[model samples]
Target: MKTFKLLSPFVLLLILIVSCSSVSEPESAVNELQVSNSLTEVEVDSIASTLSLFPNGTQFSIAFISDTAVSFYGAHRIDDDLKNTDNHDRVFEIGSISKVLTSTLLAHAIHDSIIREDQTVRSALDIEMAGDPEFTFLQLANHTSGLPRLPGGYTLNFLWNMNNPYKNFDAQELKTYLKDDLIMPRDPGETHRYSNLGAGLLGLFLSELENSSYENLLQKKIFEPMDMSRSTTDREVIKDYLVTGLTKRGSSAKNWDMADLAGAGGVLSTAEDLSRFIQANFNPDDPVLSLQRDSTFQVNDSMDIAMGWFILNRDSGDRWYWHNGGTGGYRSSVVMDPEQKTGVVVLSNISAGHSEADKIDRLSFDLMKMHFAN
Candidate 1:
């Protein structure tokens, strides 16, 4: 729910213009019907090639849906001899994107009357606060909890083991940090500053409150109902199906295991399953996922972070909710235009290699504009 620090208003505006430009080109009245007919025959490969420009050695998959149909593209690495048979079902670690899922579970808990959005962190987790006691679940979900980006001792351990600094932290360590050494970067709810620690702690608290593991809670409330059969927290479940996540150079693959902080960077899913999730998000009436839109926390005067999803206002006055994820070798993104009844899900086995996630998000927007402009 934290606003991406790198996105400036001007940058977002530019991105919007570039993404939607094709939709606004004027068609001659004489040839309008002909142009529209030709547009439907546009090649998917052309779009795929445009997406390929951003990532290096990127093996990506995309799934998209509208009111009546679903489509898939680019299952390159997923089917090759480079990986095993279950590779198609292998769950790639979705990094920060896990935050969205964690946030959703928390929201569902709140909606179920199991927890309160305004509940103080201390009360929810039953621990002494080392910093601000006024912080609430909403603040944590929105990344305004003022908690440092990482635990206090993370840097000390990370200096020696950058690949697995967080691997050493457990619930006991987090509790100790909270009681003995935590500090807020600023006043809670002051501004948007992303904190993995904040989101991680939130997940811990939610799991404790529900009297169930975060993994189980998500399965019951989100995944199972949506029929995301291939999504799982157990690494072994997708072990044989796993795709090797490639580094930018395509030299080799790196696997990241965020043991205790699994809520922050755990869970693997396939493009097909993710597409279903995206569809449910856009059309909440599906009986699988329910989205409640409340303007409780506003971001940038117009947009809001509802539960774990982001609400963005388009130039045409339409709003969309979306999120993205990345880990060591994988990147993923989901976006939905609720008013237009359209959505997209993109997953890749390469990290930042070709900017695959961003390209898919842009292309989805372009496609949605074309679908809805009429």
Candidate 2:
């Protein structure tokens, strides 16, 4: 139990960006289904059945979309007493799904020749690692940068204030940590090890390259072009659009502020906005669309890491490039099947319990399966 406690926070962080992918479109594509198709009774039942297991008063929404069709469902509250099952457009912190957007910004950087896919961190930032290993932007984005999952002193901060571990972490603090405290868990580029610090650094470095804040870069390059009106990294904007986050014990929880680490996990968005982003992923003409799919590191036969997405290369040749996220009181997921031009977005404003990620993952995968398997 002591060990579990120490690891749970990391598990929460890991839950933030779970995804799958493929190199090319699947050999067999999904037939474009009609958008007007309503959720069948069985589908609704499946969602309810899953919700019944989580007693933590969840307010969740799911949006499943294909090339031509879309479907939505909401269990505005999971606890028995608070069955306010309305489908209002509520925004939740998207956790590390923000990484995908950060990486998309990197994609744009590559597209605009602002940066190269293989640009080194030392060359880009003029920083030194412990061993002076050459780490590339690709390594940082793909989690092979040898950086730990969190920064060196993150555990202490997390323990000091579990509610908002990143509240005080800023750019200068991060640079200080990088210079004196960072230690490579493995050789840079040796293997994939999910690192929030690496992703955060990638966002910072990209923003530096463009002479803008990560938030502004994403807003101008992604949110505006994608027309994601409700997506933003501002605490003020998030507060205005925010849904109340509930813990497993039914107590209100504080919203996360990513500060300088906004690139790592500082996004607040609605299901509708995320659905729009997913839909945009299908358009081949989108400049950075293909960049999201480009493989950065091969994890194994079962998975490959893309810029900010994970590619699950299945034996059947189907690919689901996806990512999931979790914060103190919110859980979110985004899954995309590039070949089928279909995807799913799930956002929830309640959390806790070690199984939070599994619950959301099961739901997201089931929705994706319903589209691809059927």
- Please provide the root mean square deviation of candidate 1 (C-alpha atoms, Å): 10.7
RMSD of each: 10.7, 8.0
Worst 10 residues of 1 by lDDT: 14-23
Return the top candidate by TM-score.
Answer: 2
Misplaced by over 4 Å in model 1 are 1-47, 54-57, 75-90, 153-165, 283-293, 353-374
lDDT of each: 0.61, 0.73
lDDT leader: 2
Candidate 2 lDDT, 285-344, residue by residue in tens? 555778767887889989998889999997779888989888888877789887778788
Q: List the residue pairs that clash in candidate 1.
A: 54-354, 55-353, 55-354, 56-353, 56-354, 86-241, 87-241
> What is the TM-score (0 to 1) of candidate 1?
0.77
